[model samples]
Target: MLRGVCTALAAVSATGALMACRSPHEPAPLTVRVDAGSVRGIAKGEARQFLGIPYAQPPTGALRWTLPREPRPWSGVKDVGKPGKDCAQGSPGPKNPSSEDCLYVNVTAPREHHGSLPVMVWLHGGGFTQGSGKDYDAVRLATEGKAVVVTVNYRLGMFGYLGLPGLAGSGDFGFADQIAALRWARRNASAFGGDPRNVTVFGQSAGAMSTCALLTSPAARGLFDKAVISSGSCGLRWPAGGLFPGAPADRPYVPVAQGQDDGLAAAEELDCTGAGALACLRGKTTAELLPHSPSFADHLAYGTRLLPRDPAVALRAGAFAHVPVLIGGTRDEARSFVAGAIQYDPELITARTYPRLLKEAFGRHAGRVAARYPLSRFPSAGLAWATVLTDASWACSTLAGARDLAARTTVYSYEFADEDAPNVNGLHVPDVPQGAAHATDLPYLFDLGGRDLLVNRERKGLARTMVGYWSAFARTGDPNHRGAPRWRPGTAPLSLAPGAIRTVDAAAEHDCGFWATTAR
Candidate 1:
């Protein structure tokens, strides 16, 4: 059963009409009909938000680890005014908790809309172990961009990515859930005043990886007209100790065999390794299963129907869908990850330790890497290490992916380069400049934590510019429109900074040439 809502009324205008601003996990009051049934939502300012409309039935009990089934048809107006619980993952504090019964999509459209507007569906990023669709409030995107926005939540970690030996949806249940949501949006977009034919699927980080998977999946063809990938790339790879002081090398995807191996190992740890193990695994409580979630992170598997091959392999073979793609990443991409490690152990990346760290990760190439990014060239050793990883793992890899994608389709690449971009992740290390690090570009496109963090007028203006660029892309296949800077399609990514938005040689600046000679 769905949870009950606690309502708090807020006056919309001076006319004194109250709008119930309830918890996202609870239901709301306005009604709209879809294929499955009718669902009621809330009138939140400029957007009429259909919070927590189930796209697929909850993935629990007998359904866990299997493909997502279509949502069961409902009778009357299902009160979805309240948002649905987030996917069972490591997300926020207990106040806004996560749950296993999460397979919902929140529709945000103009409160006063003439039907048939373009649709933009969002997939949130939290590695593969954390985060939710609700964390991003799409009011800015809905009203400012004048588009219907859909934010989705899919299963995560063990519940979503676990690949049993002969499971029906091995290694890619989360991918299936995303495809199902897109199918739902395509079917019911007109009910929410959105055009059924025009759809844009965009995401960042893990969400970006999901979008990449969608582009390569035959099952996802025709679901979206265009695609946007941010802070994640088809060729994204991490070297040994690239993420932290001593972390192992990693990539966003693994083979289905590897995924199955990971799942089998996890099941053994849970003592559910015999026949009918899925049923036995499902019998465990949320608390009992969560500790093993991290083990399944970044485990989106290939060699399955949903993803026949790795996205990078598909990109190289030009096997992906031929659609316009907007792909980019922040400037100082790996600063947060490095800073987080230094935060835990303050002396983790000092001058003496930095050289040893690089040698451990890169072996003979350590000398070459250190020669390019000396501590003398940076404010501190931590920043130096971050710069090396950022250029090699993030900026250069994304640029390569963009070039590969552009070989077949229209691809508009960009680099978010705001020097004072807010540290949205809250990871702070003294002397570490968070210059547009990782997800800092998110606030420019969204209001994180339901609060607008653009305190400065200049930053807020940049936010509007970003929203304009994104919405324009959603409306047409191109992001270029009147009043915005000319964003041409090619290899060079448009550098996005206040008063400095223009094409930049990200390869030159990030030293991709040096990395081209080095192992990624």
Candidate 2:
């Protein structure tokens, strides 16, 4: 069997460093010994699942504001067959049920093992507000890809993110949680039939932004060999005296010409102030802190010491991790963001709102980008509006990130344009058809357990095609092979626009001119 050959090779290379093999038992169940304790996971047909393993101590009570501490080891083999309680959150739908003690990682491995398979660590996205790894099931990723799949949960919102003056260091805790999880995998994954040397960190939306942040963070170097960033890419924008876009790089770190909001004053407005700020925050419950969590305009994912001032700046300066990367976004990434951006009114999208929105999001280049993406070019103003938003925020950032990495890393870019693919969320309205909107490609990556999402009949091939590409990438840096169309790595993205998906080679895709003309 494929697994037998791989395990034999692995055993030979490992020199019996791991647990002793069966004196010949009927395919021993996949298991591992982690720092927290030992876990014996069950194998379901083809997938081996180990759920709810803590990567760090529960950050509850006095432990709230401090960096994560190592989880205490357990005395016996814990039954991690089921997931732990999702972090104490606000609500179920809009906001997840989150708690201060939420820090866990779930691992799934293929039943049959090739000694140490590549491990893919996933970070779920919810604007850093709501989302849980528990919502995702990794059975398919493990079996089909012949890889080890790990999903993690980190602190969120006020419990995970509120940056107060006398508290912990600026911006991170959540990212640090991710790093801790990776460290655990580095030390223990081998026992679970995974390669410690070959790790890939991948995520979407805020998760993707977090992964990109890891590329430049000093704390995360050498933890992974490759990265995959989908959708949201972040940078600094300001609203107050605190860190904002345009704050002078020398004294204060922020992006230029981005915005002019008083960040510190705004945090103060949210009641995050003073020396005991951390202590006060720790005393508050998840429910009490919900209202204070930044949303809409106040939400800032970039601009902080942890994020290193500016990602693009660091990337251009070649100050980021030199690793293989796959960066891309859906064709209509902003339709979901539109619910909040336009106050739920699709009709509000116009030449006026379009330009204003651009200005609010991109500063000076707003008008130029508005001109380049005038609503007159599309069937409806709403369509054009959505296009511009997705292209500028998701597509543009994705391509630019790839371009920046091109100098020191192998960068491959793509755009998901499977029009018939079903929208993954119920937010789709009569006015807005969620054509390959954000995260629509996720179900294609994993089995999604039992959750059903849009998958057109003909497009089923596309999902398999994507999984093949992704699994190949996890094993090897390059994402090209048989069973899928030839893919070429380039500084620019290979367009998935409309009908035929074209692989852009040495020549730049339309993105080069799109970004150049859009940038003032």
Candidate 3:
């Protein structure tokens, strides 16, 4: 059952005059009737927020690892004043608790908007193992952009993506959940003062990968009018000897056979092997499953009805939804990942060990990689390593995907180059500058981390510009609007820096020419 606090008030009258009195009360509920039921949200400033609204029945017991089921209709008003518990995963913090029954979506809309505004649905990123939609506050997007915003919560790790044989639609339940949320939005957006037909799906990192997957999935066609992908691409793959060390360098999706192999291993570890393995696995408690959850390296299985082929392969073959796309990555995308490693082991990286590490990461191409990214050129071997992976794994790969997508529809690319962007909560490394790292662009788009981080005039201006571009794109297919810099479609990407937005030849900037010849 849902948990929250409510206060009762008493009315006093004298001489036919009445006044209501209470000591610090909750905001009056703002009720809206949706297809499933009536829900009461809370009003805060210019935005009305409906939090913890379930889009599907809880995926627990027999339903675990299966496609999401539609939530049952409710007879009375459902209280959605508080955020829902995040899907069961690694700890986000002490305050953000998680549960197996998490499949909620939060809506934030302008309190005094007129009829039929555009809708922007958000998907959070945590390598498909962590993060919740509640991590982002859409009030700034709803109030400033004048559009309705919806943030979704999907299953994570073992409960969400484990692929065992005989389980229908295994390893892709998380993707199914996202599609369900989009379907829900199409049916009920009008009740939240949003246009059902006009919707945009946007996300960063793993969330961005999910967006890319949806673009390629036949099941997700017609769900969204436009798409935005940040710091991720369908073509992104980390080679065995590359940035992620021992992990395989193939594309993100695993085949069904590999998924079943993983499932068998997990079952053996849990002592649930044999004919009744599926039943025994499902009967395990949350605590029993938490320690055995798969890492980020575990991937959603492809070649199913939902995704007939790999996302990159499907995109290149023109087998994806023909929708306008905004795709790009950060200028220094690998710094955050590399810096974290350096912090863990101070002696982990050094100038003398640079060439050896490169050989271990790049194999025969290590010599070429070492020549291009010499340790003498960078402040530390760690920075040099990050630069190589940033160009090869992120920038060049995303550009290749964008070129393929451009052939079918309008595709606009960008690179976040905020060299001095404020350090956000996660991805923090002591004494190392983040330099527009993986998720640094998040604060500019949403009031994430904290408002104080954006108090500076320059940061505030950039945030407004980003919001304008995002909302404008949701309204129309294009991100260009009046007052903002004109964004044009081309191979060159628009550089998003503090107080600056201009097109740059990102291929040349990141040395994609060298990577194209050497790396995958």
Q: Which candidate is the best by TM-score?
A: 1
- Ordered by TM-score, highest first, the candidates read 1, 3, 2
Q: What stretches of model 1 exceed 4 Å from their correct place?
A: 1-30, 91-96
lDDT of 2 by residue, 323-432 (tens): 99988878777665553334455445555655555565556776776677677777655566666555544566566667778888888888877665665765755445
> What C-alpha lDDT do the candidate models reach, one value each?
0.86, 0.66, 0.81
* Candidate 2 Cα outliers beyond 4 Å, as residue runs: 1-31, 92-96, 234-273, 295-306, 339-343, 350-371, 452-457, 495-501, 504-514, 517-520
lDDT for 43 (candidate 2) = 70
RMSD to native for every prediction? Answer: 7.3, 5.6, 7.3
Where is model 1 poorest over a 10-residue stretch in terms of lDDT? 11-20
Supply every candidate's count of residue pairs whose N, Cα or C atoms clash at under 3 angstroms.
6, 21, 3
Best by lDDT: 1
Which 10-residue window in model 3 sums to the lowest lDDT?
13-22
In model 3, how large is the Cα lDDT of residue 11? 25
Clashes of 1: 6
Q: Write the per-residue lDDT of candidate 1 for residues 1-520, one digit (tens) a residue.
A: 1122212222222101111222323322356678888777788886788889999988888787889889999987887776789888763467757888999998888776444678999998988888888889999899899898999998998878998898888989888999999999998887777887999999999999899889999999999999999999989998888877777889989999999999989999999987867888889988789888888888999999889998999998999999999999999999999988888888888998989988977889989998989899988998888998899899999999999999999999999999988889798787787788999999988888788988898888888888998998999988886688899998799999988899999999999999999863
Clashes of 3: 3
